[model samples]
Target: MFSSIKKTTQKLINLGFQDDHANDVNQKHVVNFSYLVFCFGCFLLMAMSLIPFIPIVFFVSFICICLAFIGLRCNYLGHYARAQLLMPILKMAQVTLLTLFYFGSESGFHFLLLHVIAYSFIVFRADQGFTKGIIVGVSSLLFLMCAFLSLKGVYLTESKQNLLLVSVFFFIAIYFSVVINLVMSRLKSANQYLRVLAEKDELTGLSNRRKVLADAVNIFADSVINRESCVFAIVDLDHFKKINDTYGHEAGDFVLTKVAGKMQSVIRPIDKVGRYGGEEFIILMPKTRLPQAELVMEHLRQTIASLVIETDKGIIIPVTISIGLAPISPEVTRYEEILAAADKGLYAAKRNGRNRVAVSPDFQDGN
Candidate 1:
């Protein structure tokens, strides 16, 4: 039962969000708030119909429902800026001009205008300071106007007026609570995305040098303590600069992204692969010895050799890689030592031939 309720609520919140804007946080918030406004309009329409029917109140409720529908339609059509401006303006007009004028201040409709001030700030981004100020300033002035108009007279009886005021206050509290929760949730998601950007390579989508090295340090320490074997391999694309010079940087970027994806697909889940630097990648394999690591690197080298990339200009490009492996032995103390050994092996591989794997001489005797 709880699951069904959750799913239904989610559907309503996502009512007007199409696939293009599905990942947009601000668009999602706008859709959710628009849903709330629709529900509010329905509630008002039903309540006013059941009570002592006032024609003007019923008309206002109907207009609210229409305005909410129009706002949602605008969002569905990807007119986000239009929808954002329309919702607050329509809502403010309905409350301050219509409801407050007809039902008087006793109805508590003026309180909703105050919520519009905060709502405007949430919908507009920080960079949109001028537009945000205009919306907030207008809403504030309208709220003050309502406050002054409240002293004129009361239209409904004392009992009806009290009920209406309480209901309005209740809805206002719920609206603000939902808005605050949405803001906090968006902030958390934004922070997580920023962290990923920091740790990830922008071009190839691999772990950056810092993150991979950090993991290598911890893995190295664990291997030393448990007397386990760990392999560190440096893989460099052969003649990468030549490819960039011949095919252009766009083609170079395409090859790098494709190669990174292929390498990630071939490596074990426990192994770490990171873009160490330009045209160079680092692979850390824990609990793996020299021979096994060599075979894995050989497979990766062959896989890359077979890859054919077609550039936008209809040019075909084939690539190959050289790999160097260094196994961590009991004699190894720091992770940096293993990295240095790997670098030596990489140079040997490049010297011997571009498309081969070389093992560090220091660990060759141990293997």
Candidate 2:
């Protein structure tokens, strides 16, 4: 009975081991749950604070609580995008306006209003800032005026002149918030673009060696649980220095770009190709086996051998590459071991000839 139960448990474990797919799904669920809990907490805080304000505050708090609960539940139950989008709209424009009305714009809870504009700034960064600015400016203006009127006891039945003044202030606040968020969003995008360019090789759109190594360390961590096959191939341009001397550095750059493009074309969607150094490029193939990886490298070799790069002298240069394939199974532990093996294979390919494919002996038995 013990042996039978152990076997059954092993089967169950296998079912749960969906490799990388399971990890992605579980992490997303956790994020969704956390968002729900946060929204619920905000609602609870508002309700507790306003419960003592007779029937008027009590009724308003009750409605806010219901809306919050609905948003929380929806977010928790797989309607993630809908919940994220709808909750801010409901909270900021609907219940939030009411909250501002009771507490005033200068109330301690005024910071909550910033969340709406901030979320918009991040998610809608691509949208026209002028348009978003107008929308937020208008929304803030309306919110501030309503709050002012509510505090002055002219909210429900207001004197016309007083209402006009309140409306003007509301528009001003909205306009200011929109302008601030738009500027912030533009700055954020510019920084991100600059960072990407800094880490990338200009000639070949591949990551520089520094970025490649950093990304490799992160990828290795995921390999522990996923146990998926990872193949690392080191490719060197044969006679690269000769190409540079014979044709010039411009020709060499042309060869490099063409090689990088060929590597990108042959590799699978999940694979990554990066410029490792002067004439060396690294190809990282995730969840791929030796035979599948070899097929890709072979294609890269042939593609490079066939490429016609246009140089500054108006000469079309032809180039070739030598590739070394090193694969690690789930059983492998050390990242360095995989890299060392690939390097050895690359050396072997260089020794054999300028244009050939070499496979590491360590990964041969799939041990």
Candidate 3:
């Protein structure tokens, strides 16, 4: 039961469902839900207008409802970026003007207009201070025009010449809340992108050593609680420095990228693979026993052995990997202990002969 729960949780993490990984996935979900709400509002407006026998207003509401569905359809069809840019702008304009027409100046509908102005500014960047300034200037000009028209009895109710007063503190509080959220969300997204860069190898696009170590700690914790074994393997390409010397470093880089691709292609999704150092990669497979890990590594070795590379000189080269694997023991309490055992087995493979898999001394069969 615990194992099943662990597997489910791991699946969710892999799917980027956690709050820490919010920036990684689900960008369109919020927008889609918003659009859905707007569609419902459109239908509600249509129904409410029909009760008043308002044919023209009902027609407008029907058109707005259709446009809302169009937005939802675009979102569903994967045109998420376009939907985000266009839908809210259209909806805000439509709702603000329509509500204003129905209810005069002092109606709660003015709050919707306030929200539209806030939306315009919030959707844009705070860095666009000039653009924001222009929007604010235009909005204030329009409000002044309306105030003048209120004297001329347009878009206004009875008392607007004396009703221009507003709760300044309330507006300030709401605007501050919106601005703070926007800033924080932008900062969080930027940090996530930077963190992803820090955790990945630029050349290979695989996890860096730091990320591998982080995964190791998590895997160890899981192993401890679940009593599930994990395997760590140190993989080093044979004669990599020689390739760099004979060919240019570019050709060596070419080989490294290709080898990284191959390693990534052959591994299970649950495994963590990374460049441990120059010419050496580490593989960690949680819930894997030694025998299965060995078979996986052996296949990787054979696959890489037959791997052919061509330098710019039209010279062909074959590459092979030396792998040393060790399964975690119940007595082994630290991640480094498992890593050190794997490293020891790695040296043993190098010493006895390169291009083979070696099991750690303590984990050797019949021990």
Best by TM-score: 1
Cα lDDT tens digits, model 2, 83-174, are 44554465455435544455444332334455456545543334447644754675576556555544533223234334434543554365
Candidate 3 runs further than 4 Å off: 1-116, 123-127, 148-195, 311-315
The estimated TM-scores of all candidates read 0.86, 0.55, 0.61
Q: Give the Å error, residue 101, model 2.
A: 33
Clashing pairs in 1: none
lDDT (tens digit, per residue) of candidate 3 on 5-93: 75663443223123354442333433443454455555755775665466655777787777766766665566655565555565545
**lDDT score, residue 230, model 1?**
92
Clashes of 1: 0
Ranking by TM-score: 1, 3, 2
Worst window of 10 by summed lDDT in candidate 1: 18-27
lDDT of each: 0.81, 0.64, 0.69
Q: Name the 10 consecutive residues with the lowest summed lDDT in model 2.
A: 14-23
Give the runs in model 2 whose Cα sits over 4 Å from its true position: 1-160, 329-331
Clashes of each: 0, 4, 0
| Root-mean-square deviation of every model | 3.1, 16.1, 9.4
Model 1, C-alpha of 125: deviation from truth (Å): 3.8
